[model samples]
Target: MSTFYDCLLTGTFVFPLLGSLVLALSYGRLSERASATVGVASIGLAALCTLWVGFAFVDQGKAAQTLTLWHWISVGDFQPTVGLMLDGLSMTMLGVITGVGFFIHLFAAWYMRGEEGITRFFCHMNLFVFSMILLVLGDNLLLLYFGWEGVGLCSYLLIGYYYRTPANGWAAFKAFVITRTGDVFLAIGMFLLFTQLGSLNIQTLLARAPEWWSDGGLMPQLTALMLLGGAVGKSAQLPLQTWLADAMAGPTPVSALIHAATMVTAGVYLIARMNGIFLMAPDVLLLVGIVGAVTLVIAGFAALAQTDIKRVLAYSTMSQIGYMFLALGIGAFDAAIFHLMIHAFFKALLFLSAGSVIVCTHHEQDMRKLGGLWKKLPLTYAGFVVGGAALAALPLVTAGFYSKDAILVSALVSGHDVLMLAGLLGALLTSVYTMRLILGTFHGAPKSDHAREAEAGKGLVHGLPLIVLIVMSTAIGAQIHPPLDEVLPPSVHGEGFGVDLVEGVAMIVAVGGVLFALWLFTRQRGLVRRAVADPRGARLWQFWHNAWGFDALYDWLFVRPYRELVRVNRGDWINTICNVAPWLARLSHDGLRRTQTGRLRHYAFSMVLGSTLLLLFLLVG
Candidate 1:
């Protein structure tokens, strides 16, 4: 029998590429349903192949597995192979990418059912799945980069899927520009790694990293920081996070797939994959932790003030990724990955449920105008509760309790007292805002006419993913310790009861946050409204709501300054440089024009003068 690993090595990557080709050849001949079916099946097959490979690797007790198909590029001493590397880290990422990805493709089939460019939508989706697989499976930095840039291209296409909307197009452009800035640093880091280590292979890099560290090389720290820069931009951490809130302008499924499950988590995966490098540079890891902690708190506060349904979820996603980064920074790599996995489940559930809400509500996202939806869409409300519980890290009710609490515990035990406190506060804020979102959107009186007519749809398409995710979310926390430790390295600190403590405290904080939210939004509505409307209260709300104006500061410091420099330099240096060729052409033309007089006398005189000048110069010399 051919095992799943065999199929993964041969089938997963090829299936999507082949399916995409088949769809392209079929082109407009195929109906929308047929095209959507083909796209979904391709990714479905890829997911199966990923699962198979995961089981095979786990069964064989292999820490890492690599399969090389062909030599992609070779120049002098440089060589990069197109290959797949499956490890604990990449395997987890593969599962999320393919599994959640397949579901999103399914959801899109229905979401984009009547849209004009259905075929193009499927095409972009298949390409996205292919790029994500390559990203997770690549054995070297260069191949990974190919997948990285591929996903970026797909993101640009999908975010502007409705290119007619100038806002959507601008949002897509913003995502592209911001992420590309991070990519520049990532590229430089890869170049440095290759120059210093002479290899981009993951195993080889890890094996040689210690030697460089012992020799007092700066490459390790510099490379790690550069990679963090890329992660920050991609994951929407702190300073680079503003674009994600705006990215909700894209299709909801795009938001669920790229922002939630796959693309944003790429940064967390990169950090975990290169944990050995970070381990060698403890200072860099500390910086990662600090930045992550700050992002978590700031984004949590931002989520608290959002009225748009998707933007609220977007901020929550940012805040959640910050927790993963916090774990990574504190040397809790496994915890970070654990939280990432659990986050994929709930975040996808939340986004999809939100999509269904938006679909039924006729695209109205403002919570102020959305109320009393629990009766209209009970299943969606149920999904939201389950997902929100997970988001709040509410004890044993969901997967978040296990993964997120473990992170807080790890922080506390690692003696990062400040980080631990910040994480707890973030957790509280998460509970508050998420519950606020639920109560405001689902539990109150119908604030808008749309909700009065809102009706729940069949649960098969939308509810199935939520159900699957809920089960995974519930089961993930219990599966954390001994089983995970077999593949993952032990926690930085020796094992302790941090998990138990975290769970208990998480329950208390989550309930408190929920109670606080109810008090603020439901019980004390007039006060809340007054606070939002008053200048003093509005100022504080606006500050938190605008992500503490990090975006504005980045614009002033980075975006505005760069644009100004371009304008000034364009007017001065570039204008002069651009004019130089034309100026030279005109000079040559003028010199030649002197010889082009329409008179034989002038021509002869010019020739004699030239000869005399040549002779005089020669004689003088």
Candidate 2:
């Protein structure tokens, strides 16, 4: 039993559960103000405890620390322990989940003011924090899975927080169904690993994978691919990407926390957490890299055509996560995690700031209708600019520049030149769409009557969280590469691939993207209008606007076929069986009804005939 175990059980895991109990007990009895305060305080304490664990692990100078709580399951030789692991990687994730979680809670308190289900909202939020911590801190696959499902449940509840709206329900269902697809693959991958290695303990499996499957074998590749399926599904990669955009039907805070900062990033976290398994199968890594690059390009283009403010950010989240996947796919696990951390800070800030804007605008999300918001909501506009800079990877202006740029650079050094180029193009596209979003919503003249009244509130409820995120986003770049190396096993850093040239090109692309968006939306609106009027240009715009019709293709390939099979079977077998049962029941009922008619003579005659037949049969026998 390591000292880390004691700290985790005593602090990290226990406190949130306790807090949740308190909140649950106080529900309805306490005032809304009190409940919100308690919710924030609980998560705030959890964040502090997580930070303590991070520091303690760093001070101990250990690569990883595991504490076994109990035997989760035992099936003869198959045993999996329920426990926690405090390592450089888990610590990094824990800090982000708890810390950003605290700010999001604070932001939600104000954003959700006077809304129904406020207590329920706090309950779900606390549970989400607990689940996310479990995800990062778990020592084995089983415990990790418990948290995985927990988050899925929380996401569904929160996405449908406004259950009155049919669209919200649909959004929740879509997200659930899509993520469940990934969870299936995750389960299969875990089973394959355990069947092959006979253990689900992450440390043991990682250490033994090389010895057990060192012949460059198929099982490892198959498992890696299966795991990638889960990552793709959870992270909202291609084919599974549509649900995330629709998930914006939920509250804006839910969008900020789940879709942007925490939940959607789980897939990337899963791959990084199991870097050893992926490292063994370079073929799998290459495939992951390709999928990531493709998703990045496609999602960036999708963002370019979106009209809703949250949808644009949703697609941007997918694209940013794709970059992280590309990093992991190229064996830059640390860089991927680093980028994930930095992306969380800025993306959460963007979503939260967007939430404030949406709230003040009376929930009108069409970017085309919003303009000159910068004047009315200067603080939000400032936050938006910082977030946009981060998302665009604009030079040395933000942490995103350092982390995202590093991923592309790492890919080049690892011999994936095509991916590196695609990644760069994706970055450029990210900038174009993000700037389009900022300018269309806040820069141009107000296209709607509501914009003039939109303003940031004077309360600390909104400003304080944005201020904290701004500070963190500015300083986060310096924190990524150092302390991580001390507590986690150092990742395989590739040779620098022409740092100056790559940096120069990335900066140029990012700047060009921003400039182009500004020019098109501001100075060259006439050009955009002319292009949209032309048939050929309109087709191109439409294609991008509909997410390249990936959803349609999926429907044709998977949904239509499945529904057709059901239709055929319903008519051929199911309907036949159902008809027969009902028809036979009707006949039996009619015959019985006939016998029940008021006819005493018929009854007596039938009784006499029955007695005669019985007597004759007995005599013959």
Candidate 3:
């Protein structure tokens, strides 16, 4: 017998999965409208299922439950189960994955209406949801890794959906290969945990982790660092952080899904879910904060130099994820996940609206070539503003402010003043880049004749999800009480002036950054344009524009060396030896050719010589 919650939990991932199967099976059989309807309906059902399960879980007192389905593997004393788990953490992740995922799917339905192979696009997107659900719901590390690898595969496929372009394929491969490095680390960490403690069951692992290893033990630190490696790759943290920006070659919907709701969030979820293990390695945890803080600053400035609209959002995504990492590092687990949720809304909103703008402007993404779109697409413009405000963490109004303030305060409380200051600086940079993004497209004079007024009848469908996201982004902070409070670390302070002062300073810095961007890019464009055109500013521009030359550095270091090795071993040295064996046989046959040149004479002479030798031996004997 199963509870109603069980049914809903199973159906959450299943609904979209079934939808994906339907799309994949029908292939060319279904009409565009039918495919779109199925695509949207399937995800909508999944979202509904998530809502129902979440309600039941909450109503039942949010008591964590691990529902095991069956024995997954057995090797005499070692077995892991395959099942779903529900708690504050998984539920929050579920809501965001399916909820925001639903809207993104719907938005894509409209955004990708006219394209050939639209069914395939929806199919991949649905599959992504299913994979992500499995990831968040799985009750054990192995199952989570299954979902982990699943999304990576789907990401590669979706990112390279436009397979005609070589660049798209390359981008997809780059994402796949780079993230695989992190996966290797994750696998090693999993192996380490299992061999050390003999169980990977989430409850068992979490329960026994601290007992099995001392806080400063070598094995615990190594395991924690290895897991961090995987998280860094998946979440696109520093060093492994370069792949995410290039992932913008994907469709706007794919970008939104990958950046906002699914792939990037997995890393944050990983650390938060395994907080016990991390707590054993405080230095590693502190390193997490450092990585996050550094990445946020890097990404913020990188966003400033981006020319492509999606790239700006792409870098912004990296920077935001960095904030989550910082939070996790400082033991602000709940705040990290909380920010993860709010970021999903606002970031998805921005990407979706960016899609609308791109579609209306005839696929124009370069902001310098885009201008005066606020009047052209007022709804999209409004959604962009909402998302931008949240992204910029605009004081008390936006959701980002609420969540980000939590992180900054947590940093300070955790005795990470340097990290706290870095975060504030990143927030300021966030404000600047976000304003630059908004004004560059909406305020400047029309840069191209392609920009035109959007038709409500046709364009309104695309804006549907944007509106929902806008509302969520603006209002979600109000309801962020116990739902977000349960899974994270306890607050470092009660309601006090200290919290208020931190909030106030964050607000002022945020506002200052936005004002500065507005002044420079709009009112003072004439004055600053010349400076940017000057040698020093030009150098700065190139540095940020090229993502601080990380890509070039990687190419020179890893890519070129690998390519050179491939060239050197192009024939495969082992295979070359095999090639020589055949060549020698041919050479020996050629050497024997002369012996057989005159067949009759050669044969007769050989026989006579053999007979004569035999006779001589017989006579001597």
Best by the TM-score measure: 3
How well is each residue in 1-621 modelled by candidate 1, as lDDT tens digits? 144455665677778787778777886688988998999899899888877776777787746667778998889878889878876777778778888888877777766767887777788878877887888789998888888898888888888999998999999999999989889988988888888888998778988888765522477888888888888888888667778888888888989988666789988888888788888777888989998999999999989888899989999998899999999999898899888988888898888889889888877789989998998888778879888888988777678888887788888778898998889999999999999899989987898888877877664665677677666667563474323453355566545476566657768998898888888877798998888899988999999888789778887888898998887787687688999999999999999877786999988997899999999999999
Candidate 1 TM-score, C-alpha based: 0.90
**Tens digits of lDDT, candidate 2, 333-388:** 88888888899889999999899899888777899788889988888888899989
lDDT of candidates 1 onward, in order: 0.83, 0.84, 0.88
Q: List candidate 3 stretches off by more than 4 Å.
A: 452-460, 476-478, 482-488, 494-497, 571-573, 577-621
Score residue 275 of candidate 3 by CA lDDT.
86
lDDT of 3 at 185: 97
Candidate 3 per-residue lDDT, tens place, 180-222, comes to: 9999999999999999988887778877888888997898899
Looking at model 2, how many pairs of residues clash? Answer: 0
TM-score of each: 0.90, 0.90, 0.91
Model 1 residue 214 CA deviation in Å: 2.1
lDDT measured at residue 37 in model 1 versus the true structure, 0 to 100: 90
Question: Candidates ranked by lDDT, best first?
Answer: 3, 2, 1
